[model samples]
Target: MRSRPELHGTNGAVSSTHWLASAAGAAAFDRGGNAFDAAATAAFVIQVVEPHLNGPAGDTPIMVYDAAAEEVKVVCGQGPMPSAATVGAFRERGLAEVPASGLLPACVPGAFGAWLRVVGRYGRLPIADVLAPAIRYAEDGYPLLPNASRMISALAPLFRDEWTESGATYLNGGRAPKPGARVRNPILARTFQRILDEAKARTSNREAQAEAAIDIFYEGFVAEAIDDFMATAKPLDSTGSRNAGLLTGADMAAWRPVVEDPVVVGYRGLLVHKPGPWSQGPVFLQQLALLEGFDLKEFGFGSADHLHTVVECAKLAFADREAWYGDPNHADVPIAALLDPEYSAARRALISGAPSSILRPGSPGGRVPWVPSFAPSSTATDGPDWLAELGEGIPAIMRLTASTGDTTCISATDREGNMVVATPSGGWLKSSPVVPGLGFPLGTRGQMALLAEGHNNVLAPGKRPRTTLSPTLVCTDDGRPYLAFGTPGGDQQDQWTLNFFLNHVDFGMSPQQAIEAATFHSEHVPTSFSPRQSFPLGVSVEDGIPETAIAELRRRGHQVRVTPAMSLGKVCATGARSDGGVFAAASPRGEQAYGVAR
Candidate 1:
């Protein structure tokens, strides 16, 4: 059962991982803001509330559908490797892969720049208007959710012992705030205020003002603070050692988010859109391609047969993602051939009755199939079964991040027919020290890059690390924008999204039903994070998938891990209809996610 009712609005609808952030988007729409305005507002609010999951120092890849232009464009908010970040630099440290958390994995902060682009180009409101909610939340204080409080508490020991700046930022009086307790971040508030103040000075045009704010972040005080901190400090990283970051002011100044066409695929009757190879987004389309030939609805949604077929397809697609997906600008990505109908049919032919316990990335268009060098000895898992002691009903937001890792998502659609779905992630508080006086930390996205030579994702200056932050947009059969959806799980983002999309498209479920349904995903391919492990034929199913189904899956030579019904995915979605109605839904698995409309 869904915890809350689906919100229907004729004018607009918004959904996000945090209730207040949803309200912020709704409030923007109430002020006559367009979808971009509403989404930008909510995105900032998420940074303040879901600090453990994302921050201003994080990255966001956004999908925007402009009703006037009748086109969908992607804002590539992911930052690139610093100019000083070279494979040789990492090799000098004797590291096989970038450390999961620290300066070593830091990238140019992109969240602020991405938000600026959204408001300046597509939004009806000024940059200051879009950021008001976040500023108020930061300065006046907001009730901290249990998920945020718990994340802080869990990492409090590390902060206290090593990363004191983070401890000072997250803890109050050196203690994690209780759930629902009022919390404030005066420093973060000042940071936003400073940007707004700079933007206000460039009163010539709204776009100019927004660009001024971006300059302040990338070229002004913000950049200075970050450079100064990294130059002087040697903070503890995931390797249990101190390392200074290689990112410099030049990297920040040289970086700017760009707009690009989304990677597109025709799946069944819908036209699916995703970010390019810089993210794992294309894997969703690849999975769809592999599953298209199957009689999906005949097996019935949630059935063991349906589950097995989809899970198997996921493994095949993710294996390809591991082998071939990377920064298309930096690497020669054979995406066109990978998405070809003939190629998908060939990949589909590989699926059989019993599960294949191996990573099998097919040769696309006769090119050699790419594979990583380091193979994990054990099955890969993305969970913190040990954290169950945190108590019952701890929001899946924390578990989603702690278990598999986390990010934050926002979906919005306005009466004007414009839509935006953005997945903003990276720079978790646990990743590194909070920049002094900046109230946020740099992103650890560098961890996604491989250290091995000859690999496409190997560390290189100005190249984007292949990120797991994938947002999705889909169009109706007739080519009109239909739905925008995404989730927060690292590798599982595409898997959970595919599951939810199939529920709605194939099973005829409503937006809320699609999100509320139990979800599952496969870990059969390599994960994006360090150690880059794969689990031959591993599948994780939520508890609601019947015991008989689990038994059948195991019988099919699958290693099945069972989780609580709602513990698998933290997803939020918004849908638009030709009838001028908008629908919004958020996963109730974690009470943090909410859908709001009026």
Candidate 2:
């Protein structure tokens, strides 16, 4: 049974990982804004409410379906490495890989710029109007989430002892705030207010105001603050040592988010749109390609055969992601050949009843696949992760980052068939020290890059890291915008969201039912974050799954572990219903995600 009612409306619908964020989107819709405006509003609110999962200095890959243009485009807000970020630098530090935390792995923050572009290009609202709710939440205070409080409490010592600015921002008078307690970040509020003031003072045009806000953030005050912080702050990193960040004010000024065509693939009369090889987005399309050959409906939903087949297929696709996906501007990713029917068909032939113990990346188009040979998995970060006690993070759900933080998701749609899904992640309080006076941390996204030469994702200046932030857009076979959906949980994002999508498509379940249904995923591929790790044969099953199915999976040589019911993903979705209504759904897992429509 669904924990909440299905959200349906002909006017507008929005879904996000946090209730307040979703409410903000609903408010935006009420303010006579379009889906793009509502989504941008919610994305900023998510940065404030889900601070542990994302920050202003983080990254988000936005998938947008514009009704007027009748086109689907991806505004990639993922920042590239600083000009100084090179493999030789890590080698000089005597490190084989990038550290999980601290300034050394910092990248030009792309989220703020991305949202600015949204407000300028697609949204009807001004930048100040779109940012109002988040500024209010930060200034007047919003209730602290249980998970956020737990993360703060766990890192209290590290914050107080070392990351003083973070302590000042997160801790209440040197004490961790209890969960659900009202919390405020005046510094962040002031920073945002300053940007607004500067923008309004300089421009009267809405789009020009958005551009001015971008200048305040990237080429102006925000970048200066980040530069001052990174220049002197050598905080503890995953290497268990202090290191300064390579990101500079110039790097911040040099980067801008891009709006480009999406990587498209067809599956069962639906056209799935994902970001390019710079992210793990294509991994989802690849999985669909492989599964297209299987008659999942014939095996029945949630059946033993169904679970085994999907899990095995996930392993094959994700392996390809690790080997091939990277910044297209800097790397020669054979994405076209990888997603081709013949290539996927050949890869699908490898999956059998017995699980494969090896991480197998296919050679697409006869090009040799390069899988990095790394040591066993390690979570050697600067801080203690309460993840085991909290039952979250990489080992449990597939680690998306090397640090203790995960990610967040937001999706929005309206009566006009406009849709948007933004997966914002990185720059966690646990990953890097907050910049003084800014109340946010620079993202450590560069850690996802390999230091080894010859690999496409190897550490390089101006290259975007191959992030696991994958948001999805689905369209009808004829190209009408259908759904915008995504989730958190790092490497598990695609896995869990795919399960939810399949639940709706193959099982004939409603959006809410699909979200409420038990979810599962495989961690059989190498992790994308720092301290890259892999579990070659492990398949996590939610408790609600059938006992017979679990037994069958185990008997098939799958290392199946029964996780807490609904512990897997925090997926949110907004879609156009056949009845011409906008429908939305959110995962009730952890009581975090929410959906609203009217």
Candidate 3:
């Protein structure tokens, strides 16, 4: 039984990690906008209300099914490393790993440009309509979330002592404000207003306005602020030392959001689409390819046999991620060979009745595999309980103090068969110091890069990091738009969504049921975050899972970490129904997540 009923509508549907953001999307639909416009609008609003989880300077990978083009496109909103960001530069600094939350690992901010581009290219409404909600929330005020408050409170000492700009933007007289207090960022509001003013001055056309807006952010005042801030700001990071960032105004002007085709795999008649190798998305497809061999429905939903098979497959797929997945523009990722049926079959042979402790990424196409190992991450005993829940977006682990990273999700669908889903993350309040005047932080995605030279994901000038911000889009057997869904868990994104997809397709569960159902994931492979912690033979499960399965998992040598019920995932989904209607559903795990349709 689902805790909340799935919302159905003949007009449009919206589901997001936050209720306010979903409501903002619904408002966009009421304004005669399509799914892309609704989604972009919601994302901007998300940047305002969920500041602890995401900021405007973060990354956003969007999956859009445009009814006009009759094609699905993946928007690469992840920014590349700065021109000065090189392995040699990092090594010269005497750093083995990129600092977690500082300017040193900074990259160009990508969310504004990506959102504007998606809406400008396929949306019906004007750019101003898409940005108004976010601007209003920033200018006026919105109720602070408990999570955001906790993040601020936990980092209060750091903010007061070092990240004073962050303290100015988020704190009340150098102290973290209470949850539910009215929070305002007039500077952020003014920043967008300036962009809007400049864009309107340049163009009267809606589409041109979008392009003009993008230019303003990347090449105009916003970029100038970022450059100025990074030019002199020395702030504390995961290294426990203050460092300047590498990102410059030139890097901002040089980078642009690219629209590309998504990597896809067929699963039980549905075409499952995920972002390219630049993201950890194809790992989800790899899992799908392997699971196609198993009769999961016959294994029964949430059964010990089912969970074991999924976890084992996750280990194999993620092992490949750690060894191979990277920006294809910089390196050759054997994605095609990795997804081949023969390769999947050969890898499937590795799964047994018992949990496997070995990390195994298959040698696809006779290529050698190499996985990096790292020291354990530092955790503060006094940190908030939500630390692990914060998806490992921007990584930098601190042993002596505290550091964290997180992200959020947005999804929308309309009656016209337009669908869009995006995972906007990075630049969390705890990720980096707030850029002065911009009221946000530069993303530390470069931290995901490895110090190991010649590695697929090694730090390099102008190369995109292998991001975990992946969103999934699905199509019917006939190639028509079906569904869009994603969550805000770093390494767990593919694992959690893979389980949810199986719950929907294989076990015949409804969308709401699939999201609310018990979830499990294996952290057996090395994490993408700093310190690169790995848990060999480990599987984390919701307490909602059958105790029998837990005991069985232990019996099979699986070290299970049982978490509180309804605490694993925060997935949101919007999909098309066969009867020409649309549906939306949000995970009950995040009380703020909501689904609305009209």
CA lDDT of each prediction against the hidden true structure = 0.84, 0.85, 0.85
lDDT for model 1, on a 0 to 1 scale? 0.84
Q: In candidate 3, what are the lDDT values of residues 1-598, reduced to their tens digit?
A: 7789879999999999888889999999899998888899899999999888778888989999988778999988899999999888877877767766678878888887899999888899988898899999999999998777877887787778777888899999988889899999998899888899999999899999999998989999889988888888887666555678889999999988999999999999999999999899999999999899999999998899999999988888988998998999999899999999999999999989988888887799999998766534432224333243222334222111221125789999999999999999987787888888888887778878877777898888999989998899999978899989998778888988888899999999999899989998897987787556678988989888999999999999999998777777789999999998999999887588898998
lDDT by residue (tens digit), candidate 2, 1-598? 7788988898999999888999999888888898899999999998888888888999999999988999999998999999999888888987777776778878899999998898899999888789999999999999998777877887777788888999999998887899899999989999999999999999899999998998889999999999998888888655666778899899989988889899999988999999998989998999889989998989988789999889988999988888888899998999999989989888999988799988889998888888878743233433455322121222222233222227888999999898999999887676688999898988888878888788988889999988999999999999898989998878888899899888888878888899889878887987776445567878888899989888888888888888778777888999998888999998887777889998
Which regions in candidate 1 have their CA more than 4 angstroms from the true location?
Answer: 1-3, 375-405
In terms of lDDT, which candidate is stronger, 1 or 2? 2
TM-score of each: 0.95, 0.96, 0.96
Q: After superposition, how far is residue 28 of candidate 3 from its true place, in Å?
A: 0.7
Give the per-residue Cα lDDT of candidate 2 at 528: 76
TM-score of 1: 0.95
Q: How many clashing pairs per prediction, in order?
A: 2, 2, 2
For every candidate structure, what is the RMSD over all alpha carbons to the true structure, in angstroms? 3.6, 2.7, 3.0
Pull out the clashing pairs in model 3: 100-396, 103-245
Off by over 4 Å in 3: 375-405
